[model samples]
Target: MPLENVHGDPIFTKINKVKKQYEYLTEDIETDVAIVGGGVTGAILGYYFSKANIHAVILEKERIAHGSTSITTSLLQYELDSNARELEEYTTLDNVITSYKLGLKALDEIEQFIKEYGNKCKYEKKDTLLYTSKEYEVKEMKEEYEIRKNAGIDVKYISEENNPFSLDLKAGVYGVNAGAQLDPYEYTHQLLDVSCNMGLKVYENTEVMEIAYGKDEVEIITSFGYKVKAKKVIIATGYNTQRFTKRNFGMKTVTYNIATKPVKSFDGWFNKILIRDNCDPYNYFRTTDDNRIIAGGEDVDFYTNIENEKLAKEKYSILLNRIKNMFPNIKDIEVDYEYCGGFISSQDNLGYIGEDPNHKNLWFCLGYGANGILFAILGGMMLSKLYKNEIDENLKLFKVDRFDK
Candidate 1:
């Protein structure tokens, strides 16, 4: 498959300066593990594998961190795509609680990495608000708050009488220290840089054309016909995994985003909290380190040509007007960037990680859905441990064959 236009003019790519350039595969190579993508998820895998003394190499069809990673909102939160009560229909309530805890653990892992290395990705811990503007949905919001609070999560409930945000909210769940945001592109490079120092090789403009699985090792042939022999193969190629398998992993959609230029003031946007509303095709808002407000989430069904200029204009326009209406007090809301990218969501709102049950040495670390970045963090930790023959119980929750009959 050819490289499709996975993203538009994303804000992260324009704001951050190029830090490093990697060469394409010039000669055949062999390693313990071969990562098939060079985005944030692949970089995270490289970091963990190198730290565990595993020989790993990353292969990218294009430049690193230029695909779906570039367009990510990077709103790190412990919440799933649905409320606990709703998700229970697909997964156990206990599992939902566990996933939330795992998300927090992933957030802490990112913080620890920033502390040890420098904070090159504009990392900041912030609060999150899941609000509902409709009066009828107030009961659902209260149930969500109670579920989180009962799970020992630090959360507060706010109704119309005590709402603190500028938006009219019938009910909301205020998650304290439960979310964070960062520059996904910068963080990808930072992880790759650290991994390179620990003996991880990365190749750009090197697309994997074919893979021949062997009894003990798999041979991956690049577009330039260079071979990579690895004992294990991890597909971290985001939602572009049709060549690797025929199984339908999840529902793919195009999510749009618009970023405003640095505003003079935030007005009534309390703490600039990472805000999401309880709507079917929801919208989320977050403030950048430079004072720009990013609003995303007008999703449409995925199509072969994601670069539909006409639909893009419509979605971007919707997002622009949304931010303006949400924060009327903030003036001069000029859209600095407009972009949309492909996103995937699972039935249970979780990611697929660990080895494929059918393919012997083949693995997948697909962190689909709203919690993608956080799920990728969890993937890095769990997959690395699996390489050391240590089993993380959480792996069952993300089994690649969970949907298989």
Candidate 2:
């Protein structure tokens, strides 16, 4: 299947100065593992697999980190799409707590990577505030805060009296050191660069046209008919996984984002905390290394024609107004960048990362929802362990067919 235009003029790609290019596949290659897609997810997988001494090759249909990674907000939160109370309908509270801890573990993994390899990705650990402006939602927000606090998380409950931010808040959950932000484009390249040093091969502009499975190995044919013979295959194609599998994993939608020109000050932003509202179609706000505020939300049903400039303008306008209202005290909140991209969310608002039960030696590392980068980290660690025949109990939480059964 042909790849659709998955993103608009993503901010990260435009601002990223150092563009790294890789050669496309020219001759047939063989590896222990073949990773399809060179975005952040695939890059993370390559990093982990290469670190584990696994012979791996990454094939990207386009440029690396030029897909959904470019448009990602990179707000590393240890929270789910829904709060514990709401997610309890789809999963148990204990499972939700476990997922939160897993998110923190992923955050730690990223920090460790930065410590070992230098923080070139604008990595900064920040607090996260999940708040609600509406009076009716205060109870629900309080319930969420209590659940996290009771579960041994470092969370503080905020009410109208104790609210610290500029935004109107009836209630909020302030998670201390529970989130971080980074430059996704740079992170993807950095990961690939490090992995390449460990003998990870990456091929860009090389689309896999077909896959033929054998009893023990899989053969992937590139668009130019060059082949990749691998013992295992991993699909990290983000939201565009339908071409490889018959499973309908998640609901795909288009999420809009707008970045502001560097404001004079982040006065009322309170440590420039990563802010996420408890609204149905929630909005999230974060700051870049250059002090520009990037806010995104307002999701619509997925459409193939993502280049719809008219629709994009309308969504951008909505996002622009939201930021202005949310921080009216901050002057000159003009939009410096605006973009939209396809996103997916599962029933439990988590990612899928495990081998396909129906297809031998085939695995998926698709990280859906707002915490996709974190999920990708989890996938990289878990899948690498699986390659060594070690079983991670967390894999069951992200099993490919969890919802089906």
Give candidate 1 regions above 4 Å deviation: 1-7
- Looking at candidate 1, the ten consecutive residues that score lowest on lDDT are 1-10
Off by over 4 Å in 2: 1-5, 304-308
TM-score of each: 0.98, 0.97
Q: Highest lDDT: which candidate? A: 1
Per-residue accuracy of model 2 over 153-253 as CA lDDT, tens digit each: 99998999987788888999999999999999999999998999999999999998888999999999999999999999999999887679989988888
For residues 202-306, could you state the per-residue lDDT of candidate 1 as single tens digits?
999999998999999999999999999999999999988998999899888888999989999898898889999998899899999989999999888878547
RMSD to truth, every model: 1.5, 1.6
> lDDT of each model, Cα atoms only?
0.92, 0.90
Please give the lDDT score for candidate 1.
Answer: 0.92
